[model samples]
Target: MAQHGWVTQTQNPARTADAWWRDAVIYQIYPRSFADADGDGVGDLPGITSRLRHVADLGVDAVWLSPFYTSPMADAGYDVADYRDVDPLFGTLADADALIAEAGRLGLRVIVDLVPNHTSDEHVWFREALAAGPGSPERARYLFRDGRGPDGSEPPNNWRSVFGGPGWTRVTEPDGRPGQWYLHLFDVKQPDLDWTNPQVRAEFLDVLRFWLDRGVAGFRVDVAHGLVKAEGLPDWAGEHGLLDGTVAPMWDQDGVHEIYRTWRQVLDEYPGERVLVAESWAPTPERLADYVRPDEMHTAFNFDFLETHWIAADLRESITRSLAATAAVGAPTTWVLSNHDVVRHPTRLALPQVGRRPNGIKATDPQPDEALGLRRGRAATLLMLALPGSAYLYQGEELGLPEHTTLPDEARQDPTFFRHNGEVAGRDGCRVPLPWAADEPAMGFNKTGATWLPQPESYRRYAVDRQRGVPGSTLEMYRAALRLRKELRLGRGDLSWVDDASDETVSFVTETPGGSVAVVTNLGREPVKAPAGEVLLSSGELEDGQVPTDVTVWVRQ
Candidate 1:
């Protein structure tokens, strides 16, 4: 492959359809912020089709899109009203078909978001549930229950919403009186579906087959741990455990595994060996292992890896734990750094605060040092990509985009902000539109110069057009690393720690078919002697034959 050019490779490669996802580098695209084709300020299917070339050029095996399902825009499309059709906010079903076709033409596969835990309040079933009254079959499809107080006024339990407030909401009876309460673990606009209902199970299975027929390679199962609740719907005794990985009755129930097993059968019915990846947050790695038990999903996000602090020891432990946990179930671990819901890793790595989730920044909070963060972010990227499994790249990370941390209060759209009464700024900072052109309106995200979320002025420098083809640019660095990762077949291998590494450094060797590659990351503040091998790539500029601070180097041993 040319140093500045891309090498085109077909996905699946006649190398056994089931093995492609084992080590695939899939790119995650949050559609609303990716690009806008019709100048509607929101990214549409056509816009994504236009930009598939960019993802293809990055050498990713697949693109895992966030939801574009028909919805009322509650929870940013996660609350799907219609699972079978595309939202007008994105485009029509035809546009989605075209996107799949275009992606295939570019040697990339499409894995769409599958939101099965909840449905928008506007969904036909939800509306029917409300109209049919308590104890009706329609209401049985959701988690509707009688309230605790006199005349059923108060919620049945003390369960708190993941966003904020009580997880239950009281509904008015058809007789114009206060009535039973319904559960919505997320925003009240998203009511949780009752997976125990046979109707609910059958409906989602059909929804899966409908999309599978549309030529999608797989699904990035949203809230994969949340479909089932413990029997009797008991309330938790302690705090809502959204981030601390607490085992709530509302998540990671045993029944969810059966659901995925059924879904796996549906995927097997397809020709391309379609996959299902869980966004599960179980209480332990062993518990998480249940979701990918060979007959279930293909892989799951390693939140342990993503949430690990920048410390080398913490990262090494997380990586080892993840590898061992998944290996126990004969599955590959999926490594991810940043996604739509969290602060971008660049900014997160710069902060002294190491919260499990990115607490949105306030103007009064200590600002991140961008220079320091970018160096660490690059190093972390190289370290993650060098690991021995599949990897996911969030869009805009290639351009080294930091979170837009200073948006005005009125501009925030994340439901978490409103639910928390602004005590948390919410995740709007990380969902700002991507910068495609340095000077164009909305950073070339939309020709109309408007976006659903405002873009920061700082985005101009990190725009795609500004960095493309620029030597040593973050974009180029990603392209080069991805190309080399494919050439080295680094993703498919076994990884073991290097014994010679110091405490401040995390070192591992990946034994691949082609060669054994050593990866070293110096998290310390001083340069380290280069490992004894031929240097292939470095996250930061190397110093006189040494790895600089906050740098990761790949060595062909």
Candidate 2:
């Protein structure tokens, strides 16, 4: 395989000379679930540092660590309390520095998560603002409004919070007079900052520079679209009365581009090699492209694929739409099949027609055929890594981990569950601690105590130590897929969907400057004739010239 150097300049619009992320595969590590050192029973920076070898061995170019900053854990660290220091629960600032250094030693670039749209109420700045009177300068730092309404009886508007209630919270003044109301789009503890304020914008830009100066490679900006809001603060009409309405007008507001432009300028002060990935939930290609508009985010997660219906037509449409939209904005596209916030892909797409479990749990299972489900899940993994754009592998996803949503009410950690009346169970399942040893207590994620979240009993069958040397294990399959992606130029190539002659199959071809490769998959239950090609790799047992059912084939010509 020939190594392609970064293009400093390019003549073709589809090809960029300086896009470092074009060929990069990023592994996402949810800090509290990845690994726990010091027997804390919760994952921390030191735990992640010790596990860098596992990430590097997968051949990924970088690792994107989900938020580990000082926080109240309201949204699992998305509600940041301190921008410059590591939370004591995770480790000290020194542990973070060591993690960065260790990742570099393994040739893996480290990208930290930055949550700038809101801050934890415990944040010093938010506390100071609350302590100051209405006339104080600190009051302008957040969205504080006088009184509740014109009648002074209710909230100013019927805005609903994302977590399922009124977005506004009224606070009384220290002198016994009624103080102003504060806005929180997610949780009341995570009050939204007033981006309209110049001082607020300047302060966040300084935070960006702070990390860039610390030798960190880049950031995964949380809620990139939620940075700015409609300045009028008008009440949204349609779902205005519901708790979900609070974020309607403010989310993905067009005015956000201005703020992103400012952040891009601040990022430009550093070297061009640094990366910025935005977590925008907008599924449309045009909307997703807004975050990666050449100068804004270096790349944005193309969540359309992650949320796409598990059908051939839907998958093809997502890829085509994503490619066209990214090309229009002169930006490259990145693909993610699973993340901390969503159901695992294996469980999401395993069955042809999967729905909520009988108990109404999204990813939990009561199905009759468990072994078949696991096999199909392995098939989904092959499809995800073979796609053209940059791929994001969630923590423990490579081991075919299924979501564990059986935690009792008292054990549920997600605040969204309580806030939404359990209508939205939240992301607790995907955030469970990773299992390293099958027989060890807590699956070897901890030594002496129980984990912050319960480890699944099924983890005993799929633990890393158990699969490390198994040839056909899910862990080995992941390593092979990743190596094939790198050695065959599938990550940096032109992608085209093949017109399948049969309804039961899905296939595509990838072409790079070096060579071309074709991938075909029998997505059906029955065996299908292999497409005419030289087979490079097969998912199932392959005889001399025959392919097995539910198999994926990679071939080079």
Candidate 3:
């Protein structure tokens, strides 16, 4: 593959004068669950455009739409079948164009998901690869290798899927014999594309240009760290999980950076501050920083911060390290609390912090305390907003929604569930449809059809209609905080720790052009005296002059 030099000096004409993404609050919309128009039971592009008003009113700068590309819905939309067109289930290319125009009209930039690391087994290229048999150019576009056994029956290596089971699946060759195995770090339906192939590189670059020309503000690069594997399809010696940060041959290879450098050039061609946000899971903050260097990507998700336990000391340390790491590369860090993949942070924070970070907990597992979880979630949001740089808000999280932990087994849709044979419940709980109305059928998510995933009766209480403008509602808190975040210019500021805070609380000050804002969060059991400053906002009711446990307060100093 030809390597492109980093073009650091060229400025993109499409870049917004403000470079909106640099401290922007971007909302991640899981289209399938966000809103469904046309009574289709599934959310679509028009549905998202219809709800842009709500997002605009929330004061976010951009909206990152998860994959709506043509797919078999295997691994949901992550198993992309066609990068150039919208899935009928989503809508048409015209619908996406209308969406981009409508969002721009409403002052919200649009960023679409790009799954470059893999493609659906049903994708035209993958299907052709299978039909072309081993050693074909089509097969070379993906990771297909001869098995290690005498009859080539065994897999090439011992790698396992992040969803469980073997990562490689043997395919019957066109000649009718058991043949070369293909790699799928996730589901068997999603075969990892071989970045080593020039065709694959040219295809994605053109794909980026297609959307960029259609006026997408940017792309959220999925599995950005795993696009390039080590040479010779080496065997595994490290942990098999995707985001664990273990040193693995299949992840965060140096070659991936070269790919991003090429991608950066593609992004620089357009204006409007065209950006590339990475969903990378490199081992350390320092390693993660490499993805966002000036010549590489624009930003990478701070999973280190997201996966950290709900401990004040731990969170402070992670936040500190994240800021330092991004600073080293001159890039802003992006923070996210909950997304479609993980359990709602509200519920996750409420649970007892024990063992490895739990992605989701089944109803049979120890349940989180609702009150405690909501309280902590609100506090955490405030703490995140007070930091310097970008923040990605998952849909429905602003409503203080907790995970629907009791979904019936038959209703589960995540591939992880089926792959694990129901032992592990998977991520379907967090991807449930958003509630829009307290009294409307399907919570106003669908026109007259059932939601793709059942919404709990509990969701009615948290519906948008019920919470809108209600004083102290989670929705209202988020609205006010976002408005204040901009007025105080916190996003494009520098963060520094407040040295006098106790270990059980995390305190920091963001020095921005507007002013210095102090944020103090109490994660302990007792109230702590409010730091000396003018109190601006509190995630919960303050007790006298002190901040209560599981609460965060902002002050102007």
Candidate 4:
């Protein structure tokens, strides 16, 4: 690590005036859980448009909508059947057009999710492939191969699904007898596309142009790194330790870079500084940086920091490594804590800090320490906002919501839950609908008193109306921090270590055009002396002029 972080007097060329995504705060909206405008027990495009004011008021630069493409809903909307059209369940193509127009009116750009890795089993291409029988051109578009055993009874390889079953799903041939098996890294409904095929590449390039012409700024690429697999689909003998720095044949292949470079060329053709954000889970920061090289993606999520424990040494190391690595490639780092696919950070951080990260909590599992988690969560958010790069905020995180650990097992809808025989709860907990007001039907999410997933009783306390104007509330704190983050240009600033920080705290000073801003977070159990400066904002109240445990403070130098 550089002695004072990745400090540079030179500005990255990608930070040109219109390249907003480089230092922007993009909010991720899981369409199914954001707001139900139609009162049909599910969120839709109109619902999201209705809620755009709240998102804009939060000072976000853009909104990344999760997949709303026509789907069978087997893996939610991720199993996209049609990339060019909106799902009827999520409204229609007209509704999506209206959504983009309204968002632009509110000064927010839109980035839709693009699932290039796979298509729903019901997609026209897949259906045609099924009808074409073995060795047909349609079958060549996907990873279709003959089964290994007699009568094709076995899967071709030993690859297991990330959702907890065989990666290969056998399909009957056109002649009615059992035939070949196709690969699906996720659910059976989502068959992985063969990116090696030229037609597949051309289709995705067209998909990119289709949305760009409709006014979307860019895409939050779903399974960005998994699109290209290593040659010959090799078998893996090692455990898939997601964060253990293992490189699977199916992820982060070198061929992925060329694909992005092509997509980047399409983005440059547009008027606005279009962007591409990769959700790559590369084994190292250096490898993750490859996706965002000058001619590739604009940014990739920093999972190294997201998976770090709440220890100061580990966090500092992660941050240091991340900034150093990304800066080397002239790409701004993108930070995130909570998302639709994982346990909420507040709950995750409150648990025992020394173990494998929980996939999702269940009623039988040890629950989170709510108060402890919120404090730590708040501190972490403030720390993240003070960093010099772009950030992504998952919906409902601003309200400090935790995982619904007690969600009834019978109501779980994540395919992982079913695939795992209900042993793993999956991600339904964090993806629950947001609560906007107390005393309103479904907490202001809908009028029919229904939600796709049940919200907890505590949701009323975390409702947006309950915290909107209340001082020190999580919502207000976030608003204030965002306002200051932009006013002070913290996102475009340079970060340096605070030499006097103790071992239990991570402290840094950000230098911007206006002046210097100091940020300190006390991860220890006891309060510690804060860096000397005028207190600008804090994640919590100061205790005797000291930063308390699980708290962060921002000060002006």
Candidate 5:
């Protein structure tokens, strides 16, 4: 490991299946809020490129950037208007290229988000479909069908959008009459692409090449389980719950595996072990493993682990099931706590009730116990990193930043907020611009332009400048943990449950250099007994040689 945890150029020169990603630590960067290099309040490629050093200092192996492609911002950048180009809001293509080069220079691999299931309404293909009218080749590229009613005024089916409201949006004909409807699993502005259309498949393949040619190490495939739908796009009665429900016809269809097999072949054609990660949601861990079979993707996000509450039994089950399923296919398991799309873990763990599924917190909502949430969050992270697989860190998470739970409704931008008729506040709370300088304007997220999302004043204490070298600070804890994790090769270690584990706590031992290290976590109120060992790193101070509540300790037994 070099200064930035980068391998020397001579290392892995053949670019074979080095499998670096198997145990890698990737940091997800939501560029809209990462940093603003220019005077613009919104973050751009230059902003991210400049601040990447901070990410490198955290000792992550790579950076996973959310969509920065041309978009209408209907669902942030998820409504991608053009996959081959960068959005002006983020910067130019040259800027993207420079960012990739800079990340490589820092020994950091870059992984860009790839939205293959859908395209923005403003995308040229969608625009062409709109102009070409129904029954045309252009219209064939998307899921366009006639309305169900006699007058063709109603939607084609009862399928609901993940963002609420109707999934099928009726489009007027070129002659200006109410015509056929297009399927949009998410926002109305994001129409689902018809994978059955050969041209559509060709276009996305080209998009992958364009970015890979630009020097991105790989892609985080958005809706990886959704490139294909059921035969007739049949009606589904249940509400969509990606992180917590049975698979739907419109999601995790078997046909998706065929697409990934092709994608895997394309990825293997390139050198440097270019990887593909699936952002998939399935009915079970076994089903999720299908997306990462050796012939398909390299890995899939372990959402079951992410959705599990801070319970010992649940966490152990999720981890065991995930590792077993992924191992069955010989693929690495990917662990993540928070991302731009979800509420921060600290806030999620601290909240008492589950009023909202994916919608973020609000000022009017019951506020979470911030200190308790953070304590548990740190404990959870230590336990996660100690597990045997790759891990992902959300931006600002290393600083122990909680979701902006008090963000006013007027400042909200996530489409979920508007789609739910303001009844449910959205993910904006977790996407606020990060606080880099406690004393600077907008916490040093930007120089002059107004932040796309307002930053909470409480972020001052969690600012990078405030915690840079402070002992016991969340940022420093993450740095130390990452350093130790790599030095001890903990990600590749064999894991086994400790005999003394109880219902309230998880106790496991993992093979290390000379012997094995024990990881013990206390989730319940009562302090639990821990195995006698020298403390290597602890999420919190050990109390009287016992593991305190919301604490996780790594000990050399």
Candidate 6:
């Protein structure tokens, strides 16, 4: 076995089949909020290494680590300054290597987040591009434009960045001359790279090779659809001048397929089984499937389930559309109910009676016991895993941890919230530290001190240490669901919709090569009659196999 970036060779070639991510459950770990090894109040690689056993105990096949590469922390590590080294704040390259090794030892494949769409303003490539002249080769590596607006006042095009404000940022030359402008879809400090540039494409391929050679099983490509843009820099139409004074058309750009095709070629060079899961926010299933074509990504996280309203019809329609879209492309699909960037489903879908208000407002009513929210979370989890696709579980989701947004204004560390005038509260609520114990402060996530983000107070009832062995706990439910999924061979199977007498219930049947399983879920709050079958698993407070209302049931027909 050779140690390089994050990969090591296996002694037995036969172990390749055990790579396991094809139908495997993946747990997403946001490093900055996972655990603190040296008590720096921030999660580091060594801290994650120490926590690998906890993840493994959840019965997941892999751990998807969010970005921990050398960065300015502007976007909490999405802005990479150095691709090859681990940030000093999160330990060194040696620490990453150790984490990878420990994960592999625990039989958990490690997948890392790859942000190729852009880089930090302080990155060496951006620095070199700035040093190069207007027509220099280095300058061609990024999207650089000349001049001000047509009226000599604003950006060249009526394009508003995703983070609010104009997408263009003015850059000055060393001679104090206003040189040109660059495009940043999110923040001015994070400049978008020119994927059309051959050199730029080749350089990123090298970065991928650097990690693959070391032993990383795969990547979760961030903003996978934003890699390409409309060529020739055309101006968008309309008085987009009203809101941030601009609007940019962003959808289904040409030449993106070419870039992905090239990436596929590079990934094929590795001998072991590796996967590439893309994060594409395209609303339409047809467009989202484009990222997972045979030669592109292995799977694209289908986020429609995350954004859809908590209703039977909508959830059923989204699932059917996702299955059909991926099946059409002969590409596998992946499902995610929650991630670092979204509101936790447990907190998001809890009924109004549970003190969760609609429209993102805090409820003034008394909060229900945490068990009620946990029940809803478990139901959603079952729904996600039962679907015919790979599934992703956010770090604290296994414990049914809800979101935490009680941080004081001074402690709000997310740059998006601050930079965007709080138009978006940002993703800090879902990125809180993992709670390892109920008795300890900070929930044992940090032994030396507090964490970068505040730990959720509700963790006292949902910590891993307290729930791992408890019957009917969220952790146990997740383990049971995953084990049942494997025993029934749900992932590598064909799905058929079951027509229920009631519209409030969504039921589907899965037929695998080994056997078949039927899953029925009642997405409504009202009591729904159970469809007749051999019930296997339920998300209700059942004793002696009697299911309660508002339950999810898996049965064998």
Q: Compared with the true structure, what per-residue lDDT tens digits does model 3 show for residues 19-113?
A: 67778899999999999987778999999989999999999999999999999998889999899999999899999999999999999999999
**Candidate 1 has what TM-score?**
0.96
lDDT of each: 0.87, 0.75, 0.87, 0.89, 0.86, 0.75
**Per-prediction TM-score to the true structure, in the order listed:** 0.96, 0.91, 0.96, 0.97, 0.95, 0.90
Which candidate tops TM-score?
4
For 263-327, candidate 6 gives per-residue lDDT tens digits of 88888888777888888776578778888877887878887767766677888888777777777
The predictions' CA RMSDs to the true structure, in order, are 4.9, 4.8, 6.1, 2.2, 5.4, 7.9
Tens digits of per-residue lDDT for model 2, 1-557: 11222121112233345466876789999999888897877789999999899999988989999989988888888899999989888999899889988998999988999988889999988898878878777878888886555646577677788777888998777787666888898888999898888888888888888888877888998888787777778877655321121345667787888888877787778874887888886636788788888768778888776766555666667777777777777776788877888766666555445443222233343433345556656765676667665778898988878767465556677777778786676778777898889888788887875799877688788899999879988888889888888887676677766666555665776775547776666665566556556766666665555445556777776
lDDT at 370, model 2:
44
lDDT of 3 at 53: 99
Q: Model 4 over residues 432-507: C-alpha lDDT tens digits?
A: 9999988899999999889989999988999999999999999999999999998988888777776543688888
Maximum-lDDT candidate: 4
Provide the clash count, candidate 2: 2
Distance from true location, Cα of 284 in model 2, Å:
1.4
Evaluated at residue 267, the lDDT of candidate 4 is 95
Give me the displacement of residue 235 in model 3, in angstroms: 1.6
- The RMSD (Cα, Å) of candidate 2 is 4.8
What candidate 4 gets wrong by more than 4 Å, as runs, is 1-18
Q: Of the pair 3 and 6, which is ahead by TM-score?
A: 3
**Model 4 lDDT vs. the true structure?**
0.89
Model 1 C-alpha lDDT per residue in residues 218-279, reported as the tens digit of each score: 99998999998988888789775544657788888888988998999999988977999899
Show the lowest summed lDDT stretch of 10 residues, model 2: 1-10
Q: How close is candidate 2 to the true structure, as a TM-score?
A: 0.91
Error of 1 at 46 (Å): 0.6
